[model samples]
Target chain A: MTKELFIQGNQACSMGAIEAGCRFFAGYPITPSTEIAEDLAISLPKVGGSFIQMEDELSAIGAIIGASWSGLKSMTATSGPGFSLMQENIGFAHMSETPIVIVNVQRGSPSTGQPTMTGQGDMMQARWGSHGDYEPIAISPSSVQEFFDFTVKGFNLSEKYRVPVILLADEIVGHMRERVLIPDKTEIFKRVAPYENSSDFLPFKADENGTSPMPAFGDGYKVHITGLTHGELGYPSSSPDDHSNLVRRLTNKTLKNRKDIVSVDLKYCDDADIVLISYGSPVRSIIETVKLAREEGIKIGYLKINTIWPFPEEEIAKLNCDDIFVVELNLGQIVYEVERVVKSNANVHLIGEIGGRLPKPTDILDKIKDLV
Target chain B: MKKEIRIGGFGGQGVILSGVIIGKAAALFDRKNSIQSQSYGPEARGGASKSEVIISDEEINYPKIQNPDVLVAISHEALLKYHTDLKRNGILIVDPDLAHMSEISEFIEKNEIKVYQAKVTKIATEEIGLRIVANIVMIGVITKITNIISVDSAKKAIIDTVPKGTEEKNIKAFDAGYNLDFN
Candidate 1:
C-alpha cells in the first residue's frame, strides 16, 4: 500500500529532508518559508535529530555549513531577503565543498519585496548570488508533490557532489496543499560515508569525479577546510595555478556532468511549433495556457525545468520549435538562459510578472496568439 | 470532470480549513485529485480571508480558482466581494444571518445564478453547541448541495483534518449542514 498524505509543499519538503537523513536544521523564521522551519522543529527532535531557530539567515546557513562539516545532513529554509543574506556563506560552502541543502521559497524581490506573494525573482541569484567562478545545482518544483520529490533529490545530489543544492520553491507551491506519496525508507538515498583511516586521508583530496571522501569532524581526521582557494589538503593556496585549478575544478565537476545534473519534464514538444517554458508556480499557469492554446488550434508544447542550474542548455539547444515563450513570476530571469541557448534557431519572447504575481493562463494565451 | 470552489469569510472563521477539508475529502477519501490554496497576509479576527479548492477527476493544473463553479460566503463582505467571480449560473451559498440576502437575491435573480441559504453559525452554535464549528456546518451544506464528494468521505475528512477530540461536534455540525433545507 502506498503511504500517501495531503500536505503543503513546505511540509512535504521538511518530510522529504527528514526521510533523506537530514538530521540537522537551522533557520530563522521568514514569511513563505517558515513552514519548513516549523515542521522541522516538530519532527527532528522526535527522530532524535537537532533543529535550531537561528537568529538570522546568515547564521542559519553558517550553522548548516558547520553541521555538514560535522558530517550531518543539514538544511535551511528562507525566502528572497533571507536568501540574499546567506549568499556569502553559500559561496563559502561552495569553496569548501560542504554538502547542504538550502530551500529558498522565492518571493518578489530586489530587497524587502513582496513577502506574502510568490516570485521566481531570485532565480538568477541562486546561481550567481555568491559571486565566484563556480557551478551550482538548483532544482525548481512546480507542484506540491514535486516539492517532496525534488527535495529528496536535492539532498541526494548535494550528497553525491558534496555541494549545496538549492530547492528553489515559490510561494504558491509552498503554501498549496496536495497529495504526496511517501515512499518506503528503502527508496531514500543516504550520503556515502568515508572509511579511510586518519593517516591515509586528506579531507579535500579529490578523485576523478571531483568529490573527496568526507570524514566527520572529531573523527581523528585533520581536516583544514577553508573558503580561500585551497589545494588537495584543504589548506589555503594562493598560487595562480593552485587558484586556477581549484576554481576550474569547482566549475568543471558539475559542468562536465551537466547531462546527468539536468532534469526536465517535456510535454508534447516533438511536434510543437511554439514551445512554452517556465519553472515554479508559473509552470502550472503555462500548462493550462498550453491546453487553451491547443484548443484554439495552436500546436504548443512545453518544457518544465526540474533542474534550473547548469541551465539545461542541452534541452534548450535541442528545441526545434519556431518560437519559444518563457514565462516566470519575475521579469525574465531564466528567460535569458533560454535566449542564450535558443539563439537564432528559435524566436524567444519573455512573459514576465513581478510583485510576486504569477502570470495567468490568459496572459500567456495572448502571447501565444500574438506569435501566431 | 473538474470543479472549482471558493470559500470565504473573516480570518477567524476557519475559512481556509473548510477548503482544506473539502479538498482532502475528495482527494484522500474519494481518491480524486484536489489542490487547495489560500490568500496570504496578516489575517486577524474580522479581516476578510479566502481559500480556493479545485477538485478534479484528473490531475489539476492552474491551481488558482477563477470564475469558481461554487462559492460559499460566511460573511456579507465575502459574499459581496466574491459573487462577481462566481461563474454564470454557478451555485452560490451563504450564511443568511451574516450575509445580506436582498443584495444576493437581486444579484442572483439578475445573473440567473443558483443560490442556497444556510444558517451555518446558528446551527453550529445553537444545535452543535460550538460556534467555531460553523465552518464544518458550511462544509456540510456544501456537501449536501453539490454532492461533490461522498458524505462518508466528507465525514472522514472532518475527522482527519479537524483538531483532535472535537470530531464529534464537527460531525454533528456537518450533519446539521447536510440536513439543511433551503430552496
Candidate 2:
C-alpha cells in the first residue's frame, strides 16, 4: 500500500532528500527555508546521517561540498539573502564538479526583503548568480507533492552530472500543507566511482558523457579537488586550452543532454492561441486562470515548468501559439527567457507580481481579457 | 464541493495548528484534497496571525482563501479584521467571550451570515485545563457546526499533530467542542 502524507512542502522536500540518500546537511536557519533544515536535523541523525548548523550560508554550501567529496549526498536550504551569500561557493561547486543540492526557498529579495513572504525573484539568480560560464540545473516545484518529487529529482540530477542542483522553492509552497504520496519505491542514481587503482584515476577528465567518474576522498584514490579552473588531473591549469576544455565539459554535461534533463507540463496547448507559462506558486493561479479563460471562450492554456535552468528552450520553441504569457511572482524574470525562445513567432506578455503575493486567477484573467 | 476556511487569532493561539489539523484530516484520513497556508507578522507572539485551509473534492488550484465559506476568529481584533472577507451567508464560528458579537452584529446581519457562538478558550482552559487546546476546541466546534471535516478524521489529525503525551487532553478538548449544543 502506498503511504500518503499531508505535509508541508519543506517537510516533503526533507523526506525526499532522505529517500534520495542525502546523509549530510549543513545550513543556517533562514525563514521560508528553515523548516527544511529543521526537519532534516531531526531526521538525518535517526538515519545515521549528519546534520550541521553552519554559521552562515557560505560555510553551509562549503560544508556540503566537503561532505559530497567525502562520499555522502549532501544539501543545504536557504532563502534569498542566504542564497546570495552562497553564490561564490556555488561557482566553486561548479568549477570543482562537486555534486550537492541547494534548496532556495525563495522570499522577497535583493537584500533582506520580505522574509515571511513568497517571491520568485531569485529565478534569474539561480541561473546566473554564480557569475560563470557554466550551465546549472534548477528545478522549481509548483505544489507540495512536486516539492517532494523534484527534490529527489534534484539529488538524482546532481549525482548524474556531478554538479550542484538548485531546488528553487518559494514561501507559498514551502509553508503550505498538502497531500503527497510517499512512493513505494524510488529510483536512486548513484554517482559512478572511478577505477580502484589511484594511477588510472583522473578526477577532472570527462568521459563520453561529459562527466568524470567520481571517487570519494577515502576511497583509496588520490584526488586533488580545487575551485581553480583545472585540467584532467584536477590540478589548477593556467593553459587556456585546458581551461576551455574543462569549462566546456562542465557546461555541456547538462546542456548537451537538455532533452533528458529538462521537463515541463503542457496543458491544453495543442489548440491554444495563448499559452501561460510559469513556475513555482504562480503556476497554481495560472492553472485556475486557464479554466476561467476557457469559460470565457478563450483558447488559453498553461505550461508549468518543472526544470527552470537549461531554460526548456526546445519546449518553448515548439509552442505553436500566437501569444504567450509568462506569469511569475517577480517583476519579469522568466518572461525574458520566454521571449527569447519565442522570438517574433508569438506576442510574449508578462504577468508579474511582487510584494510577496501570489497572482490571483481573476487578476491574470483580467490581463488576458484586456489583451484578447 | 470545495470549502474554504480561515482561522485567525494571536500568534500563540494555535491558529496555524488548527488549519494544519483540518487540512491533514481532510487530505490524509478523510480522502479529500486540501491545502493549508498561513501568514503572520515578524513578532513570534502577540501579533495578528492567520491560517487558511481549502478542502475540495476536486483538485485545489488556488492555495489562498479569496472568500472563506467559514471564518473562525478566536480574537476580537482578528474577527473584526477578517470577518468582512467571509462569504455571503457563510458560517461564522467564534468564542462569544473573546470575539464580542456586538462588534460584528451589524456586518453579520447585513451579509446574512450564520453565527455560532462557543466559549472555546474557556472550555479549553477551565474544562480541559489547557489553554493551548483552545484551537483544538475551536476545531471540534468547526467540525460539529460546519460539517466541513469529519469528527473521526479530525480526532486522528489532532492526535497526530499535538505534542506527544498531550493527545488525550487535545482529544478531550476536541470532544468538549464537538458535543456542545450550539442550537
- TM-score of every candidate: 0.97, 0.99
After superposition, which runs of candidate 1 have C-alpha atoms over 4 Å from their true positions? none
DockQ for every model comes to 0.77, 0.93
Task: Score residue B135 of candidate 1 by CA lDDT.
Answer: 94
Candidate with maximal lDDT:
2
Q: What lDDT tens digits, residue by residue, belong to model 1 across residues A1-372? A: 568898899999999999888999999988899999999999999998899999899999999999998879999999999999999999999999899999999887878777778888888898899887889999999988899888888988898888899999999999999998988762555666667877877777677888877888877888898998888888888799989888888888789878778999899899899999999888999899888888887889999999999789988899989999999887778888998888899999988888766688997888778766
TM-score for chain B of all predictions = 0.96, 0.98
* Model 1 chain A lowest lDDT segment of ten: A185-194
Instruction: Name the docking class for model 2.
Output: high
lDDT of each: 0.89, 0.93
* Residue A191 local lDDT, model 1: 65
RMSD of each: 1.5, 1.0
